[model samples]
Target: MGLFSKDIKTMDDLFVHTLKDIYYAENQILKALPDMIEKATDGGLKQGLQAHLGETKNHVVRLEQVFKMHGAKAEGVACPAIDGIIEETNEIAGEIDDKKGLDAALIAAGQAVEHYEMTRYGTLIAWARQLGRADCANILEQNLKEEKAADAKLTALAERGINAKAA
Candidate 1:
């Protein structure tokens, strides 16, 4: 069955569905990052992608814990937003030929993904708490924190490093 296949018949259902969406997003990111890392020629950019890949693995674990806490199965609903973002990243990466400029594009793309994840995780944390799953909220909060950190790191890379090189 699909996420919307069933009516959002309960608060728990809504919560689980959002969890599943982000779970799918996180998994998609894991698949996309290797190419991002390989295409990123800057040492710092490569390292940053590697670090976020580790964090994304942790995000999957946290989502699983949230499901366990809520007595739901840890499954993914397709997230078209993430799929589009990954596709756009691939298109942009394919177009950029200069090594330094490509690194800049990669950083910009990475930050966009990070910003999207932060929003989803933030909303999920609020929903988890509203559903009276504080334990699940805690897990969601952990992912949110990591997402925020990744955003900050990407912002920094864009600000003083990659963007300058792209110019």
Candidate 2:
């Protein structure tokens, strides 16, 4: 069913729909990271992206687990927000030629993605709790922690040199 479909008549339905949204988004990120990795010019940025790529893969697995726990199918619905973020990143990356600038842009893009994930996870955790699924909330919290850490790491890398070098 489409987003805002009348089929979603309850919080549980909303929760599951959001879960599917993130599941699709995570899988898209899995597909997009390699290109971002390729475009990155900084060693630290590349390494960070690679590491997060691995973490993202595990996140997909964790999401599937949550789906099973919630008695929902381990499937995904298209997430236009993530798609737009990734597309914007690609467009910006294509427009830039300077290596340092590209790296900085990449870091910014990565942080954008992390911020999106943090919001999603934060909501999911709250909904899970409200739905009396502490188990699901706890599991989603792990993903939220990872997303926050990745954002912080990107910020640290940018502050250390990437941003200045870009400037």
Candidate 3:
């Protein structure tokens, strides 16, 4: 069912729907990260993307676990927000010819993905708590922490040199 579908008549339904949305998004990121890794010119950026790719795979597994805990099928629904973010990343990356500029754009793109995930996981954790599923909330908190760390890493990388190199 769509986000506005009348079938989601309760908080549980909304929670599950959002869960499916992130599940879909995480899977999509799994598919997209390799290309981003390939496009990255900076060694640090490449290694960082590779590390997050592994974390993202675990994120998918953790999401599946949450689905099982919630008594829902481990499945996904289309997530246009992540799709758009990835598309924008690809478009911007394509436009940049300089290695440093491309690396900078890639870091920005990675941070954008992390920010999106942080928002989703944060909301999911809050909703899980409100739904009285502290178990699920606690599990989701791990993913949220990882997302925040990933963003911070990207910021540090940029501050250290990627941004200046781009200039």
Candidate 4:
């Protein structure tokens, strides 16, 4: 038997896998956040991630809704992609000893996560629409907007706050 030979033979399987994918991603982010918070020295960046942590919790709730809307149990796969991102961030954080430098690293890491989420959200929104669940797409759009905003905020912080401080 082939590895992963169980057929994704139904829409339900696709929906559940997607839900699991995002759930794993979000959960990994939640776990990584405290370290980011601890590493950040920029007052604004630290505060920003803190705020996003709350928003991220809401994101989990939103994903749960997507799962429920499809009548599927919310769960997650290992999500090697996000796990690797988190690992990379941790490595960078460990390498940088300066608090402000760490802050910059944290911002960079947060942006990486935001970019990943943006990609997933974009895909999920399109899939939701294709599946004839405009309502699901609409709900997902909220999280997508938030991810984009988080990325934008991180950029602004890097330019206006952290990078300047680092320099």
Candidate 5:
């Protein structure tokens, strides 16, 4: 259902819809990360992306758990936002020939993905609490914490030398 679908008439419905949105996004990120890991030129960048791939897998599991806890079907809805971000990342990565530049681009793309995840997780956590699903929120907080750490690692890699190497 669309975000504004008439089917979602209650706040709980909105919460579940967003939960599915992130579920779909995390799965998409899982699909995209291996290619990003392969394309990464820097060893550190490659390693970080690989590690996060593992975490992203856990994220999908956690989201499934949340769905079960909330008594909702464990499934995903189409998330156009994540689709656009992944598409943009692929287009940019394909255009860059320089290894250093590609590494830098990869970091940016990873951050874009992280930022999107952070927002969704944050919203879901809040909504979970509001809906009296503290159990679900606690589990989701784990995913959010890891996403923040991943984002920070990407920034550190960029600032430490990746961007300068590209320059």
Candidate 6:
């Protein structure tokens, strides 16, 4: 169903729909990371992307747990937002020939993905709590915390030397 589909008649439905959205997004990230890891020229950036790939797996599992806890079918909806971000990243990465510049671009791409995730997770947490699903909210908080940390790490890598190297 679409975001504004009549199928989502209640707040709970919206929560479940969002859960599915993130579930799909995480899986997509899981698929995209290996390529990013391969493309990254900087050791630190590569390692960070690799680490996040592992965390993304866990995030998917946690989302499944939340689904079970909430008695919703574990599934995903099409997330155009993530798809667009990944496509943009790939397009940008392909255009940059310099390794250092590519590294910098990768970091920016990673941050874009993280920011999208952070927004979704934050909204999901609030919705989960409103639906009286604190347990789900708490589990989602774990994902949010990791996303925030990942974004910070990307920022740190950019500031530390990647951007300078690119320049």
lDDT computed for candidate 1: 0.87
Kindly report which residue pairs in candidate 2 clash with one another: none
Q: Which RMSD does model 6 reach against the true structure?
A: 0.6
lDDT (C-alpha, whole model) for all candidates:
0.87, 0.96, 0.94, 0.84, 0.96, 0.96
State the weakest 10-residue window (summed lDDT) of model 1. Answer: 1-10
- Models, CA RMSD each: 1.5, 0.8, 0.8, 2.2, 0.5, 0.6
Provide the clashing-pair count of each candidate structure: 0, 0, 0, 0, 0, 0
- Tens-digit lDDT string for candidate 6 (97-149): 99999999999999999999999999999999998889999999999999999
84, model 1: CA deviation in Å?
0.3
lDDT of 5 by residue, 87-118 (tens): 99999999999999999999999999999999
Candidate 4 structure quality by residue, lDDT tens digits, 86-139: 999999888887877778788888888999989888988887888889988998
Stretches off by above 4 angstroms in model 6 are none
The deviation in Å at residue 68 for candidate 4 is 0.8
**Residue 154 CA displacement from its true place in model 4, Å:** 0.4
- Measured with C-alpha atoms, the lDDT of residue 166 in candidate 3 is 94
* Residues 32-145, model 3: lDDT tens digits: 999999999889989999999999999999999999999999999999899999999999989998989999999999999999999999999999999999999998999999
Model 6: lDDT of residue 92: 97
Which lDDT tens digits does candidate 2 get at residues 111-165? 9999999999999999999999999999999999999999999999999999999
Q: Give per-residue CA lDDT, model 1, range 92-122, as digits (tens).
A: 9999888889998898788889888988888
* Pairs in steric clash, model 1: none
Which residue runs does candidate 2 get wrong by more than 4 Å?
A: none
Tell me the spans in candidate 1 whose CA falls farther than 4 Å from its real position.
1-6
TM-score of every prediction relative to native: 0.94, 0.98, 0.98, 0.92, 0.99, 0.99
